[model samples]
Target: MFTIRKATVADCDLINRLAQQSFPATYRDILSPEQIDYMMDWMYAPANIRKQMEAEGHVYLLAYNPGEQPVGYVSVQPEGANTFHLQKIYVLPSCQGQHCGRFLFEQAVSYIKSVHPAPCLMELNVNRHNKALHFYEHMGMRKLREGDFPIGNGYYMNDYIMGLDI
Candidate 1:
């Protein structure tokens, strides 16, 4: 069985390592190497992740296998009164097709609903060309908007903002 729990500071290094391992496989074909490098440095650095963990508005969750090793993670933050942004959801490639992603997503949805109890909506952006877009759609997320998100240094993410109301 897999277990999910709140992440602690000690998990930062492991989280960063996971991001490094997963990000390239997911983005190397979708984004330029420079953009991927910039994003990794800007978003997954230990300091940035630790700060997010310390922030009241953000929540980071980890998924552990039966043996208690983390194999997946999700990061989320409040976007508005009743909406939350899924900043990232990553599962190690070795563990990818085993339903871990779905499990983590369900936990996130449940947590947000319990905390907000309002008309809670979960939102995330996916690259238009990403093969995983179908997975999100299959998981019941609808495309709410589409636009270009500027990431900096002349790089932009051409994405579709998908949402699921819980």
Candidate 2:
């Protein structure tokens, strides 16, 4: 079984470590090694994680097994009236077949529904070639459009923006 807990700034190191392991594991096949390294430092740096939790209005939830080892995590931020942006969602590669992603995604939606009760929707950007595309579709999200977001240092995120009605 797994348990979900709200993550605070104190969890920055844990989140960063998890991202370091999970991000490359997930994207290694789809993205270049340089790109993956760039994105990891850009998004999952401990300082960046801290800023996200403490100042960016992002809510992060962590999923752990009985041994207290983090298995997955998700982050969401309110983007404006009636819309929340799903900034990040990752499950350890070793834990992929265990429904950890589903549990985290469902928990994220549930938490958002409870706190912001409205006919809201959640949006997320998934890599165009990410295998998780089907997973998100299975969870009732539809692709809205495609985007090539320039992150920095000549890196661009080729993504499909997907949305889920709440």
Summarize candidate 1's per-residue lDDT along 1-166 as a digit string, tens digits: 7899988888889889989988888888888888899999878998888888787466888999888988889888888788899888888888999898898888888878878887888999999998879988988999999999887888888999999998
Give the clash count for each candidate.
0, 0
Model 2: per-residue Cα lDDT over 71-128, one tens digit each: 8899999999999999999998889999999999999899899889988989999999
Candidate 1 has a TM-score of: 0.94
Predicted candidate 2, C-alpha RMSD: 0.8
- Lowest summed lDDT over 10 consecutive residues: which window, candidate 1? 51-60
lDDT of 1 at 52: 82
Q: Model 1: how far is 124 from its true place, Å?
A: 0.5
- Cα distance off (Å), candidate 1, residue 146: 0.6
Error of 2 at 133 (Å): 0.2
Report the C-alpha displacement of residue 20, candidate 1, in angstroms.
Answer: 0.8
Residue 158 lDDT, candidate 2, scale 0-100: 96
